[model samples]
Target: MVSEEEGKILIRLARKSIESYVKNKSLIDIPEDTPETLKENMGVFTTLNKNGMLRGCIGYPEPIKPLINALVEVAVSAAVNDPRFPPVSESELDDLEIEVSVLTKPELIEVEKPEQYMDKIKIGEDGLIIERGPYRGLLLPQVAVELGWNVEEFLYNTCVKAGLTADCWLFKDVKIYKFSSQIFNE
Candidate 1:
C-alpha cells in the first residue's frame, strides 16, 4: 500500500490535472518525486457512465510516462477520445467519476495448455500482460470479475486483441506477466 502522504499527493496532482485541462484545455507537467515505484507497468483509467451504463473508459496498459502525466493524458483521452462515446461535455464533468488502477508487472510463463494457466493465475489479484510478435495487450485484475472470465479465457481474448491466436502465449518468445494495483475511484 502507498503511504497516506503519497496518496494525498497523488490525489492532489490528479485533481489539478483535471481542473487545468477542463478549464483551459492544457496538459499538466508531472511533479518530481512522483514515486518511481508507481511508474512501472502502471495504468490510469477513467470510467465514465450515464444512467448506469458505460460511456467511456480509457487508459494506458503500461506506464509510458510518470503516473501523474499518464493519469492526466488518459483521463482526457477517455473524456474525448473514446471511440465508443461522443466527447464529454463540460456539463457532464460533475457526473463523471475517475477510477485509477495501477497495474503490476506481468510475468511470462511457459505452459502447454489452458489448464496450466488456471493454477497460476488469481482472478481478482493479478493483472495480465501478453505479447506476441510485435503485438501486445493487457487486462487489469478487475476485468476478470467484471467480465466473468476465467484466466485462460482472459488470456485468449487479450491475445486475440493483439492479432494472435488464443494459444499464442504458449509460443516461443511470447511474453506474459502479472501485476496488482492500488485502485481508487470518485
Candidate 2:
C-alpha cells in the first residue's frame, strides 16, 4: 500500500505529466533515487474531471510498467488521447481535477455459473472484469461507488461496456476477475 505522502507525490507526478504534455514541454523525469514503491510494476488509471463532470479517464488494467511511468503515460493519455473526448486544451487545465487509482493485481474468480459470480462480488470494493475470448471490459472499484451501482447493475454495465449483451454474465464461457484499488485525488 502507498503511504499518504507517497500518494501525494504520485498525484503531483500525474499533474506534472499532464501539464507538460499540454504545454509541449519535456516530460517530467523520474529521479533515479525514486522510492522503490514507485519503481515497482503496477496498473494505474488517471481520471480527469472538469467542473464535476468527467473529461477523460484512461488506464492500464494490467501491470505493464513501473507505477511512476504508468502514471505519466496514463495521465497524458487521459488528457489528450481519450477517444471519447477531444484533446484537452492548455486553458482547460486549470479547471481540470485529476484522480489516480493504483490497482491491486487482478485475481480470477472461478465460478460454475454467472449467478454464482454475483454472489462473490462485493459492491463498492471489488472492481469487476468480464472476459470471453477476444472481448473484455473492466470497471474500476470506484466506478461502482461513484455510480451507486449494486452488484447486478455493476455486472450489467460491465458486460455492456464490453460490447456484450446485458445478460452476458449468464453465459458459461465468461471469465470473471476482481481487484481492489487505492484511489487518490487532487
lDDT of 2 by residue, 16-72 (tens): 899998998567788676789988899999999999999999998888999989999
Residue 168 Cα positional deviation in candidate 2, in Å, after optimal superposition: 0.8
**Candidate 2 deviant stretches above 4 angstroms:** none
lDDT of 1: 0.70
lDDT at residue 84 of model 1 (Cα atoms) = 74
Backbone clash pairs for candidate 2 read: none
For the record, the alpha-carbon RMSD of candidate 2 to the native fold, in angstroms, is: 1.1
Which tens-of-lDDT digit does each residue in 27-132 have in candidate 1? 8877766786555445566555666667677777655665666777777777678887887777776776666665544456657764577788888888778876
Cα error, candidate 2, residue 18 (Å) = 0.2
RMSD (Cα, Å) for all candidates, in order, is: 3.4, 1.1
